[model samples]
Target: MTAIDIRDVSLEYGEGSGARLILSDISLTVRSGEFLSVIGPSGCGKTTLLRLIAGLVTPTRGAILCGDRKVDRPSRDRAIVFQDYGRALLPWRKIWSNVALPLEGGNIQGAALRERAIELLKVMRLEAVADHYPDQLSGGMQQRVQIARSLAQEPKIWLMDEPFGALDAITRQQLQDEVARLAAERNMTVVFITHDLEEAIYLGDRVVVLGAHPGRVVEEISVDLPKPRDQLTTREDPRFLAHRHHLFGLLQGH
Candidate 1:
C-alpha cells in the first residue's frame, strides 16, 4: 500500500549558471500508515522534500504521486505541522476554535465542529486548555494544540518539520511519544523531519537519512524495536544504539 511515490525527482532554483540544485534524482515510496523519519545535516533540502510532498512546491523534474493521483497542489489529504506553533496558530482564535478551523470550511458546522475539536484536544491531552488562547499556553502545550489541529484535518499523511526542535528535552520526548501513540491509534502515515538522531530512531518505523549537497537518500534503515516505544528501554536497547551509531557514522561521512 504505497501512499506516496516520488520518482526521479529533481528541484532547481533559478535558471542557467545561477541555478541552484536542491534535490537530485530522489525517489522513494512511502507506505500507507508507515512512520518515516527523515534526518540530514543543514541544507539537505529535507524540509523542501516535505514541502514538495505537501504540494507547496513542484519538482523541476519528475513527478510525485499520492496514491493513484499526481500531486500538483496542496490538498486536505496531506496536513503539515511546522516547528513554529506560535506562527502556525491564530492567536485570535481559542484553542478549540483553532482546532476546528479546518472543519469550518467544510459541511460540518456548529456543535459538530466543536465536538470534533474537543475530541482531538483530548487526544493531545489538551482538554484542559481547550478554551484558552495560544498565548496563554506553554510552548509544549502550543505544539500539542498544533498537533490536535492537524488531526482535525484527518489527513492521510502527516508532514512534520522539526516539530519539537525548539521544545525542552523533556517536553520533546513527551510529545514524541504522544505523536507515536496518536499515529498508531489513528493508523496514520507520517513523514517526520528532524536533526536529532535519537528522536528519529525512537519514533520512526524506518529512518531515511538524506545527504547534503543536492539532497538524496543516503540510507534507509528499519527500526526493529517493539511498538509503543518506551523512552528509557527503547533508547537503551542494543538495536537502538546500533542504529544511532550507523546513522551517526553515515551523517559524519565515516
Candidate 2:
C-alpha cells in the first residue's frame, strides 16, 4: 500500500517572466512503512520537496496525496524534523514539556501527556535529560529531543531534512542506527533528506536521487541489502559500497 502518492508535481514561484521553478514533474510513491532517502547536490530542491509533502508549500502543477487525501495544508499527520535542532526545539520549555507540546491538545490530557512524552524520550535514550532545557543539552541530545517530540505527534509519516547532518561522526552514526531501528519497529513511513551518499544508502529502503535546476528525480535505487543494518558491518558490505559508489556518481554528474 502506498502511504504517499506524489503525482507529476511541480512547483513554481512568482508569475509571468519572473517565475522560478523549484521542482519539476516529480512523481514518486512511498510504500507504507518504507524508509525513503532523498539525495542530491545542494539546490536540488530537496527541502522544497519535503515542504510540499508536508503541505507547508503547494505545487504549481499536479498533486500530492497522503493516502486518499490531497496534501493541501499542514496536518499533524505529517511531522517534520528540520536540520536545525536548536531552532526546532524550544529554549524555555523543559525537554519533557517540549516533547509534550504535540499532545497538549487533541484528547491527550493531564498525566497522559507526561507519560507519553517520557515513553518516547526513553525510546530515544533521552529519559535521563527529560527535566533539562534544550539549551542545556548537547547538539546530539537536542536533536534526539526534536525526534522524540515528533514521535509524540503520532504522525503517519515522518519527514526529516538532513536531521543528523550537524552531529559528530560517531553521534550521527548512532542516531542513524537508532532512527532506522525505530522506524522499522514502528512500521513508520519516512522520507529522509540527506546530502551524504552513504548515509542515504545506509538508512534507506530505497533512495531517490534528484538532479539540480528545477529539481527532478534522476534515479531511484532499491537498497536490497539486509535489514537491521550495522554501522560497521553494513558499511563494509560489498553491496553497500556499490550503492554508495553509484549514488556518488549520480550526484557527481557521472
Candidate 3:
C-alpha cells in the first residue's frame, strides 16, 4: 500500500547561465497498489521523472515522497528495471546467480538464496534458463531475468523505463501481459514509462500524459476497462478504442 506523491517536481541540468530545465513543476499522484503509465514524446523527461522517483537523482526544486518518507537517494524499497537488458544483466553471471544478486546483500546464502531466486525466476518463466548466462538467452528472456532480479529485492515500488521497447511486437505484448499480471497479483506499486499508447492503456490502471518542452503533466485519464484484460478482446473493446483516439489527439497537440 505504498503510494508515491510527487510535489511540484522540477529538475535542471548545469547551473546558472547554462542551466536548462528538463522538468518544470511536474506534479502527480500514483495511488497505492496502482499501475501508473507515463507516456510522452521523445524529450518529455519521462525517464528523468522515473529516475527522480527511483531516487537515482534528486529534484532541484521539489520533493518526492514514498508514503511519508522523502526520496533524496535510492532505497531498497524501490527497484528499477531499465530498457537496456544487455547492460542491466551481467553476462559473466549465470541466470540464477543474477537473479540472486540482490538477496546476497542480506547474506541470504546457500539453499535460502537459491530457493528465493528460483521462486522469482519461476514467476518470470525463467526457471529453465537458471543455469544459462545472459548471452545464452534472447532479448525478451534477458528482460525477464532482469525482472526476476528486481523481484528478488522485494521492493515496495517497481519503476520501469520503457522496458519492452527493445523487444519484437509479439514478445513485447507477451511481456506486457506478464507485467500487468505480476503487478496486480503482487499488489506492487508500479510507475511504467513508455512511448506506446496501446501498451500504456493495456497495462495501466490509469494513464498520465506528459507534455514536452520542460515536461509537465497535461492530462490524466482513468482507464475504466475491466480487469484480467485480454490482448485481443481488450484492445477491440469500444472503450479502449475511444481512449486511444482521445489520447492520440492529446499527444499530437502536445
Indicate the residue-level lDDT of 38 in model 1: 96
**Candidate 3 lDDT over residue span 164-231, tens digit each:** 99999999999999998988888899999999999999998999999988899999999999988999
Writing each residue's lDDT as its tens digit, candidate 2 over 1-254 gives: 99999999999999999998989999999999999999999999999999999999999999999999999999999999999999989899999999999989768899888888999999999998999999999999999999999998888899999999999999999999999998988889999999988999999999999999989999999999899999889999999999988888888898
CA lDDT, candidate 3, residue 188: 93
Clashing pairs in 1: none
Give the Cα error of residue 19 in candidate 1, in Å.
0.3
Error of 1 at 8 (Å): 0.6
Ranked by lDDT, the better of candidates 1 and 3 is 1
Name model 2 segments beyond 4 Å from true.
none
Model 1, 180-241: lDDT tens per residue? 99899889999999999999999999999999998999999999999989999999999999
Per-prediction TM-score, please? 0.98, 0.98, 0.97
